[model samples]
Target: MAEFTSQGGILRGQDVVSILFPVAVIPLLFLLRSVFFYVKARSQFPGPPIRNFWVGNLDQTMANDVHEKWLQWNREYGPIFQTWNSPFSRVIYIGDPHIITEITTLNWPKSSAQYAGFRPLSGDALFVQTNHEKWRIQSKRLAPAFQPHVIQAQRPCLAKHLSNFVRAMDVVAEQNTVVDLSSLHILLTLDFVGDIAFGTNLHAISQGRDCRILQLFEIILPELMKCGLFPLRGRFPILQKTRLMYRAIAELRSMAEKAIKDARQKGDEALGTSPRKKISDILATQREPDESYTFSSKELCDNYIAFLVAGGDPTAHTMSFLIYQVLCHPLVLKKVRAEIDANIPFDTTVPSISQVNLPYLNMVIKETLRYSSPGFGTFRVCPVDTTIAGVTLPANTTLALWNPAVHRDPKLWDNADEFDPERWQSGQPKVRGSYFPFSSGPRSCIGQGLAMLEMTMTLATVFRRYDLSLESGFQMEYLPSFTLKPKNGLLVRAILRKF
Candidate 1:
């Protein structure tokens, strides 16, 4: 009787404890997680706190011009500072030369979460490739074709397309109507990129019609930028407009795949004795004995999309901004005009690399790139726990290097914000990381040589043939998207210059 009573009592006690244990531990676990995050935040790098526990700084910075916010914060908090992006994540913004040089040279993989926004369009392409090894392989394979000589090999093709561009502008000039230079430039760049990249003329300029792909590209950025910051964008039906953009991008992918197939079938026989290589041709012809070294058709499509994303906006916006800035400053325009008149022959279809000796022209372009950097910033993630800029960054921590902030830093140049092209001609030794319009180190823009050549040639071609002036009392305002664009667009009056 005594043993049975003892066993029964023990069983009842065990049941009571089991029921209470979880009740006590559930809240305890919640408390422990909160404590862990708090401790981590305090122990790791310093950063500004978010507005709330649930959303962090998303509420404050998500809707606004985020880059402008970064610039403001950069001004407020020295060269290196951190901001809580979410309860689970913190972002460290680095613009200091030493820190930027270190992170970029190390070629830190971009933070996967931050760059996930870029994936829907350019899947695993060079810009959105989260895997470092894969990125390295792709970058190396693509590097040789972007070299100056290789880019120059495409000059004749570029000149042919540019002549079409000039004819389009000439038609508008003949009408004597105010031209939206911004849209015109965007179309021109799209056609140029399409021709050079895919070996197809989109005919956006010559036909004076908007390419569906280009239109898709434009709307995608503004919506995607929002989607990138707000995860719940899909929950709202109105913002669901981005779905159409995705569908359009899918259609574009199909177009690219077809173009590649057609190009492969045709071969380089069209070029005959002298073959000029386009990016599409290079991609089609690339052969590797090892299966591992070869790129798949999908990979090629993704790469061409990356080219469009990177090349399309930056080129057009930079050119548009350059024209706006030049028109805003008369003396700057006169100096550039003088340089063009002296060096470039009036009827020269394409100034050969050696024939183009416009120092001031080069300087002006460099200064514009400095003054209005199209790529305002870049994202990098620390791969390993490392110290940078006198602070320790845990692995997977996201860092942003704000280029415009660095560009406009008063300490870096004399009157940095002033429109002064002569600063480059000052003969001062260049600061290494201070002005990287194309970025620097291993992963810098491979298309930079092509971009510079195109800009120089286009500027010489257009300004030599036409005199452009901004509409009277015109004002320029910027819209922050994937690239800084003129909010109102660039309106200009064009007159044929009698040489």
Candidate 2:
């Protein structure tokens, strides 16, 4: 009996050891991993102290002015510094123009972990595509649609939409009422993109209402920002906000699918008679010329939605900021107006792209893009252990080109904080990678040409016929989102210019 009791006690002891051993060993293994990551990140470069082993610098990133925070950090810690998204995620921010050039010119793949937020909306579209070969083929397929000639051919569509915008503003000017230029710019761009890209008459400008597509984007963009900040939110749609976001994404995808179907049925009629094919035509193609890869129906629909969103929001926000900046500085405003007056006629006839010769206005646009670019940074990832700007980065390390920091770096630009358009006019050559508002490299913004044309035309059209002033007691406040958006909206009063 004594022997049996001893044996039973030993068995119980073994059971306890079996249970407690894993609990203790598992935590020990996790600790080792955390330590390994922390050491690796610290050894790579100088950075802000990691306050928490788990959340590491994520608290600072949650602040409303995170971009400004990044700038401050860039100043404190040299040009390249490390920050953590989580214990498992280390982000290296590059502010040095030379380093930026190296990374971008090499054409490193974008980080899939960083770009996961965009996948929910853009799918495998070029904006978030990480696979090199797939992205290469897809970009090649879509390239013709945004060629210079193709964009120039769409000038008439742009002019028509701008005309509608001006007519709407004329009514507001006659009544002497405050107009939300932010909202108007968004509507105008949407109309232009809808007509030119998809042959869909959103009528946002003429009808003076938000289309269902725009409304859906209004829901999706903010959620994208949230998902970017908290990646877990994207993996699990348990929260009400996340659930709503998924629903909106579904609806937008459905709308895009329907539009694709309609375009397919209508054939070439859908893309009007422009010799240059529109984005819709390119996306609706059944197969590539070589027939090696055929775009799935879902890819067609997602790319369609991607173009719609990309073509509208950033351009609209940029135009709004451009107008605001010009108006705020009277000297700048005077020069821009003088240049516009000299180049464009005072009458309502919209000037053609070739007819306008406003170098000063172009400078102002460049300055605005430098000063208040809609996107704060561009992200990339190294596929193999690589050396950039003298630092050896481990394979799969996330890299962010901090555009705002680079653009406003005192070392890069003289009087970096000041809103001076003439800086661009200096005969001295610009530093490579110094002012990439649309980013740099092969993956840079595909629609930059169209965006520039839109800005030039809109600025010339508006300033030629009207003088604008900020609303009484107006103060500019930026909203934190996927892009830098004006809080509430920009309120301004317009007075028709007399010839």
Name the candidate that leads on lDDT.
2
Q: How many clashes in candidate 2?
A: 0
lDDT by residue (tens digit), candidate 2, 1-499: 1222355454455666777999999999999998887686678788888788778888877667776877788888878888877777878888878878987888888888878877888899888888989989888877777888888878888888888888899999999999999989989888888776666778887665546766877888877876766667788888887888899999878777877777666654644554435556555654557853356778777777777777788888888888889888999998987877777776755788875667898898888888878876677887788876677877887788878778888888888889999998769688998888888899898988988888888878888888799999987777767777887789999999886
For model 2, give the 10-residue run with minimal summed lDDT.
1-10
The lDDT, on a scale of 0 to 1, for candidate 1 is 0.75
Per-residue error (Å), model 2, residue 331: 1.4
Each prediction's Cα lDDT score?
A: 0.75, 0.80
Residue 250 of model 2: what lDDT? 91
Off by over 4 Å in 2: 1-30, 49-53, 207-210, 268-277, 285-294
- The TM-scores of all predictions, comma-separated, are 0.90, 0.91
Q: How large is the C-alpha RMSD of every model relative to the true structure?
A: 3.7, 3.2
